[model samples]
Target: MGEPVNREKPLRVGIIGCGKIVAQYLESFRRLQDVQLTAVADIDMERANAVAAEWNDGGAGEGGVRAVGVEELLAAPDVDLVLNLTIPAAHAEVALAAIAAGKAVYGEKPLAATTAEARRVLDAAREAGVVVGCAPDTVLGTGIQTARKAIDDGLIGAPVAATATMVTPGHERWHPNPDFYYLPGGGPLLDMGPYYVTALVTLLGPVVSVIGAASHTRAERVIGSGPREGERIPVEIDTHVTGVLVHESGVLSTLVMSFDAVATHSSNIEVHGPQGTLAVPDPNHFDGETRLFRLGGSEWETLPVSAGYVGSGRGYGIADLASTPEGQEPRAGGLLAFHALDVMESLLDSAHSGKSVAVTSRAERPSAVPLTSQEG
Candidate 1:
């Protein structure tokens, strides 16, 4: 890959989605000196205009950021990269367009709705010589990273196995537009599995094969918020998914992702070896308590933070990508995202076939993050 030109300047970014999630990125951009938000776009012009108007006035300078059509934003000279926060189905389409325009791209999780689409995105970026980064960068933050440090330090000797569990009644109980959560591209596994799978990859290694089983709990769900309240949406995907991932390192990770359960008291994830077990915090958050219990210890002890971006949040991955050397993949790059997607998709496939599916994709464990603040 050719080195990106002008590495010293802050990356100029154009955003292509203005949904609820964009607000988190806007907040992060306000503090990250390595990225400059130059424009905003969305299929909903009103939403795009509102975000542009709200964020452009402050430190953006001069005429400020433009609220343009998606195509206009893609072609804008000021945009060095595209931050794609579009819905899952549109991820590959928008990313391919940005790559075609000769811009690096960072996107929200799953990379694309399917591994096939994700592969195309990665292939296109490789041919274009631009970088591709994906989310669930939450793995790069203190919560999961701290847990990773303990495991690497052998607090849990020769890691043997793990369990990751996430359960909730349903997003329809609160999400205004909960329909997408039930769509093919959405589901407990696809919607929430990225965070857990990415964290597992970060803490263990890449998954090689999976055995899975899944179930659908309901055909329709009622909206619980916004103007759509009381309305029902069809559920087209399995609501509860269970799987076992065989990591390349031979660690087995049992996974349970569900929208059918009311709650779960289990740790979001737990890694076990002969000597100890790690109680990892939620992969969805940037910071939380990580506890460890040795075999002979009286109780679990909270470990002090030892690694990763301190006080970081949603868009840290973009900033990390901006700081990465031109030809190198960012720590939260597409390869890892693709592998995580493959693992999830493979699990779903196994669920249908009642057989183990060998994952065709693998990612190098992303380099570890040393303890550091975002501005450090």
Candidate 2:
């Protein structure tokens, strides 16, 4: 990459989805002076308007953000960037719209409903000469980044083996609309798997092959909390998934994700090398702390994570660009995001087909260099 360009102007951004995640995006955007969330859009006019009011005004008393449709948001001349927070199925359409409109794109996870769609988005972005970014920038945060640095620095001799586990009872227990979690594109492997898998790819490099098994443990899940009371929803996707990831460096990463099991121990991703072991913090934030444990040592040592990027709150790119100025290359752009998305697609296929799937694309590790904040 060329020497980082210093952005001298504010970035005018438009958000194209309105929901719970929007609040988190707003929180991150509000902290920055370099970006302005000038517009928002959603299918629901009322919800869109409500959310816009908040972003425009800063809250109930404040003159919140404004809302529009996908087309309007993309066509707006002031919009330097588009934050595509729509559902998985709508990712490709929104992304294409933004890129074709000559705006950069930052989308939510999975990149799209399927691998084919993700490829289309990448192709479009490449043709448009604009940047596109996908979700889970959390790995770029200090917690995971610091651990990755230590491992690369040989605090842990070349990583030989690793493991990550993420389990939850189910989203229907809390999510008001949990049906999507069990559909064609919805499964433990594709849903919560990104956070853990992306962390692995970023830390250990591209996976060479994956052997796996998957199943749906529960037919239905009842809501435990939320306004939707006593709702019994069918589980159409795999509730649990397990796999072995063989990295290019010969590191074997064993991973398991489930929506049926409640794990007792803390969820973790641990990489073991000849010298020691490093436990990465949750790969879902801009920064935090980590732990290091040597084989001879009896306990885990707390390692402070040195972070320079602020959590833009919600939008993968928004959180990354909260402190970034206009016209700067997005730190979480399409190239790396596409690699992560491709890896995820390969994992899901390996699980469903009971075959070892190889990653066709090798994305550079997720980086947070372009964005700057007070180092902590």
Candidate 3:
């Protein structure tokens, strides 16, 4: 691995995978000065070329984003960090390759398809002395962070429990290539659970055990968008998953994720304590209203934005990584991602075994981010 990122300079970034998600990150990267987009690569040369041509560095003088081969980009001298936007199944493989190349890595969520693979990524980064960061940086935004501030300020009193619900028809409705979504690495639980579970951990604490039940609503889904519209794809993963996470602190978080449901009026997340109930906004988004309802109150009150990166988005986690002091983990560090993955994976295992499964891994609630801005 390489030395610590120099805080005085922008962390030069090379991106891998030019999927739909890459656009969001590119938009965020343009607004973040802490990290520079240096290069891009994808299995599809057209995608690599398209993204490389799409990014306008505006003369930051880092030579602009170049379309290079995966091996070339990984071995590039100007690249300090690899921003992995690969599919969930290839997450660990790319992270390991970046670590092997001695470049620090920050990747999209789950860390890997399974905990076993995730541990290897973490272990390799550790042995190589490089940093490993992962996504759902949405929690580092005002919505969840303001909720965190409220809890930390004791406004919620002794945190008792939380409920996180995400209901969607399915990604095939919109995603151009949604096949992988039904495969091993994708599912409502693994696909959308990271945001909710990570938020639960952020609000309550680390989960010690989980009890879950899952079901498959259908074996095939007809595509509703793009050239593949109306095409049917096999569903190899659970479509709906409901679980109870027993936090180490005794806070129980109930999780409901589904691709089968039409809609729900429930808050994305709600934390209940003796004093009040907090209406946390969507964890999948960067900002929204974080409301609170006191024990004696009849109506929910919108709380002020008291924490998190202002105007943050997908790539902000990498910027956060660049700003982190050496020897300290970024808020979106690998540990949290791994813990979230373990909890989700355990829930599925429990779903299969028809018994509660104890989560062996734990991640500390990352340090709270004060109301801050990446625009600065």
Candidate 4:
């Protein structure tokens, strides 16, 4: 690939959503020297104005980063990229719009609500000659990267299998706007499987086929927090999902994603080989402890952090994408995100059909992050 893009200049960015997750990206942008926040936009003018007012304080100069309508922001000549934090349903629409405007785009997880939509986004970017990046940049963090280093270094002889487990009572218990969690695009697997699937792809490789089964326990959920507290939302998708993925490299990964369960003591993910087993940290966060157990060892031993962007979080992917050469894929590029989404969607298809589903999309494993800190 071409040499990494120079980091001396900042990438001018415009954000397109102003929801709860926007706060995390805003916080990250403050510490990421390679990015410059220039504008904010949303369907709700009030929310857009509020976010612009809060983050633009003496930052963008002159008008100081005022809020604009989505169309205005998309057409802004000064904006080099669009940060799409909109809900899953709107992801592809916003991305296609930005690409049509000739701007690179980075978005929150699952890439799009469906692989067909995600494919369109990628195709549009290719036609527009703009880059596409997606989140759960959490994989670029030390947690998953360190575990990846162990497997790459032969701490695990030859990866044979893996298991990923995530369970919670439900997001309605805590999320302020929890209606989306019960929608078709918001089931447990689609909602949270991105992290686990992406981590597995990072550690193992792209999956080729999958078999799945799923269940839904409740028809409605009560909002337990925010303005919607005590509000009941209808559930339209499966709440619990299980699947087994066969990776291109022949490694098998068992997955469990649930919104109906009480809890799980299992490590977020565990990979096994002939010589050892590895306990990888949660893939939703940037840093954590990774432990390893050799076949003959009596107890698990914690492994030191050896790779990834140190002290990184949500928006690191944007910074990483900003520094990637024009023609190269970002470490958190859309291809990997598309692959993960395809895997999840296929799993759900298998669940409904009671048969194995083949994954038609694939992604090359992203380049490993060396031990490095953010340049500030």
Candidate 5:
């Protein structure tokens, strides 16, 4: 266990990386009393300044969020936790820096570039006695949590298999900085697979082994919408990846992730069983309708909102972490992120080796979220 959280005070937060995703977290921080956004930083100082200048707390408290250099944010006495939103490749580096500075950390997913690097980050946090939380906290919201409750209630009756599918043309179309998406740690599987994989583990259990294959569809892609529109960028990682995961619970999950497809009609995730099939919502979003089709039923039915943060978003995981007891893992914790990373990396390894790979790492299925309201 790490040092105990002081229940009377809010966890002061400093955010690193002012990319597109920072906007979402900013909105959530406005709602969470468990956390206070104290500072914003980025390699691009202008971007950091803009974020600090734009955020408003509606006169709640804390004076205001200020812009700071990366080094300055890490050194700030007010920041009790560092929110690392850097690119996948920089995840471990930033987390280690924050841990070195004696701050808790919560980052956007895939944990790190690889399981080995993620292991280093977690080891350092362990040695430093700081808590580490990672995202795709979307699973902590109603969609997946309701689905989880359904299965736990035996609505699916011993899940036999599941299919998770996510396909996108690419992030270059919308993101101003899209260069990192094609890098080693930023491929389709590594970039987007965390949501599906983490959700699968949340609803099912940890994976023990996996078989996989992958493809690279193009040499380069043109920026579709951004300051650099029409500029072509080289693709370094496989754009499409498919894999089958063998779960420790005897459940199997088949995953399909691709940046090559224009679109797809498949449900984000579907679980099958002797009793029924569940159409889980897109794991990327916080809330959506979860539908169910029973063995003898002719029509699909939508499940009621039975679990999760009713209207939560990106950084609720940090609030969850702040509220977690001393010895418990946050719903979106590092162990799960590391296990998900190992699964994806192993899938790619299996893709290259043409053989099944054993996933040596495993994480407990994170605790399910009860129905919650963060409206305070």
Candidate 6:
């Protein structure tokens, strides 16, 4: 592998899709000396103007990125990287456009609506020869890294099984536009399953087989928190999904995701081996501490939070990269996304066919690829 890239030249970034999340991206982008927040674009003109004003007034940088349409942002010469923070459905279109415009892309989770769309984007990026990165890059954070180190050092003898869960009360209760969550592309499996599945794939090898079951908890959900409050929303997608992932390394993984369940404990992902158990932190958030539970040990030992992907809420790692010298790379990239999508597809198919679905898509870890620009 080549040596990590130095953050000598600032990466000029243009953000597409101005929304509440833009604040987090803008906040983080302003802190990074190696990154210049160059521009902003959104379908909503009012939202674009508001975000542009905020960025220019110092929410992002002294002179913030220009608020423009998608085409203008893509055409902007100063934008070296395009941030695809658009809603999940629009991710592929914006990312494909950015790649076509010969700019690198950094996108939010799920990569795309389907495995086919994700593959198309991947092919386009390869054809364009520009970098394309995905979010929840928390796999490169201290929690996962420390656990990986311990496993490498034989702290956990050999991973045997894993159980991951991401359960919540659904998004229609919060997000203003919740219609997308019920569409064919939207579901708990495709929405929140990325983080749990990606983290598992990062730790374990590729999956070999999958059997899944899925169902809808409620036929309709009421909008709880927005202008559409008290409005009934029909649930067109599965609200609950469960799957069993068999890995190439002989490890088994049980995954459960739901939008209607009230989970008391945090979303826990545990890997069990002969020697010990490693409880990885939630990969959805950028930074946090993890714990290791040795077989003979009395308690779960706390792992230090050394990495600096620290920000409030979702953009901690992005913010840390924007502010610090740490040049971040996509830990949860296309491969992980593809694998998760494949797993979800298998689960849905298995549920429908009443049979175990074999997962054919397999990815070998790239020996020449480094997870991040920051190396120890």
lDDT scores of the candidates, listed in order: 0.92, 0.73, 0.91, 0.91, 0.91, 0.73
lDDT of 5: 0.91
Worst 10 residues of 1 by lDDT: 1-10
The candidate 3 region of ten consecutive residues with least summed lDDT is 56-65
Error of 4 at 211 (Å): 0.3
Steric clash pairs (candidate 3): none
Off by over 4 Å in 6: 1-8, 59-62, 306-330, 364-376
Q: Which ranges of candidate 4 are over 4 A from the true structure?
A: 1-8, 58-63
Residue-pair clashes per candidate:
0, 14, 0, 0, 0, 5
In terms of lDDT, the poorest run of 10 residues in model 6 is 367-376
Error of 3 at 53 (Å): 1.0
Residue 137 of model 2, lDDT score: 70
Q: Per-residue lDDT for 230-261 in model 5, tens only?
A: 99999999999998999999999999999998
Candidate 1: give the clashing pairs: none
In angstroms, the error of model 3 at 127 is 0.5
Residue 41, candidate 3: alpha-carbon lDDT: 97
Error at 67, model 3, angstroms = 0.6
Model 1, 1-376: lDDT tens digits are: 3235345888899999999899888888888888888899999999999999998666554468889999999888888889999988899999999999988899998899999999999999998888999998999899999999999999989999999999999999888988888997899999999999999999999999999999998899999999999998999999999999999999999999999998878999999999999999999998899999999999999999999999899999988998888778788999999999999999999999999999999899998899977762
* Residue 169 miss distance in model 5 (angstroms): 1.5
For candidate 4, report its TM-score: 0.96
Q: After superposition, how far is residue 182 of candidate 2 from its true place, in Å?
A: 1.4
TM-score of 6: 0.87
Better of 2 and 5 by TM-score: 5
Instruction: State TM-scores per candidate.
Output: 0.97, 0.89, 0.98, 0.96, 0.97, 0.87
